[model samples]
Target: MKQVVENIESKPSTPILGHVSPSDVECMEEIAGENWNEDCAVYAFHSESLFIIPKQRNIKLSLATLKSEIYTISPIRVFDQNIRFAPLGLLRWSSRSRGLHHGTHRMHNKNQRKRLWPIWVLLEH
Candidate 1:
């Protein structure tokens, strides 16, 4: 993981154009000659082989989340304009375990249960 981060940081930063479009994804699928799958496409995008512009806002949030180690990728919403290109994920167990304070003991207790929130990665359609 450290090596991966170092590699990314060492590379010259390129301005990410924008989120992948549906047509672009279709083109990639066509170019892949029928071997394409959602998993492979996703990996390609993350690996930078697919070349969609990174959403700058999401990038910042993603970096912060990575450093905090508090979230996990959930899913990509294909057609939703509000959340198309986003790092959709769930909060980590440890993060969720941090309970709210300044309330009753039962409410503030670390042992108090919490549910994982669904994170949406908004992208352009």
Candidate 2:
């Protein structure tokens, strides 16, 4: 896959959505690789971690081709600042551990509310 990286300095403050930086955008782009796009909105934290919500969750603004196979919409954690898909397919969980290239793992089936589950937040959510 191919990704497009933009060199925007400041983070974008999307009023209703909150603040997201160029570095965050760059990180998501890198992960989705050929699948990334500008419209993609990401949830990033101070720990330099991120969560992905799609380009436009509601409609026409919807992507022509739904790329990710996993139905849940949890964001992958990309730490090394590198992008790579996990080997195992965690339908609803994030990677078991942190860092890049370390693929997703099986999800804990305690409850089924979160479409996508982040490994760390599994206990709380």
Top-scoring candidate (lDDT):
2
Cα lDDT computed for each candidate against the true fold: 0.30, 0.35
lDDT comparing candidate 2 with the true structure: 0.35
What lDDT score goes with residue 110 in model 2?
Answer: 64
Instruction: Summarize candidate 1's per-residue lDDT along 26-121 as a digit string, tens digits.
Output: 343443333222322121223322223322213222232223222222233243334233232234422122221111111134775854344323
Query: Which pairs clash (backbone N, Cα, C closer than 3 Å) in model 2?
Result: 2-34, 52-75, 86-103
Off by over 4 Å in 1: 1-75, 80-87, 93-116, 123-125
- What TM-score fits each model? 0.18, 0.19
Tens-digit lDDT track for model 2 on 12-88? 44333233333433354555545334333232222334344444342111222322211222333343335423232
Which 10-residue window of candidate 2 scores lowest in summed lDDT?
Answer: 59-68
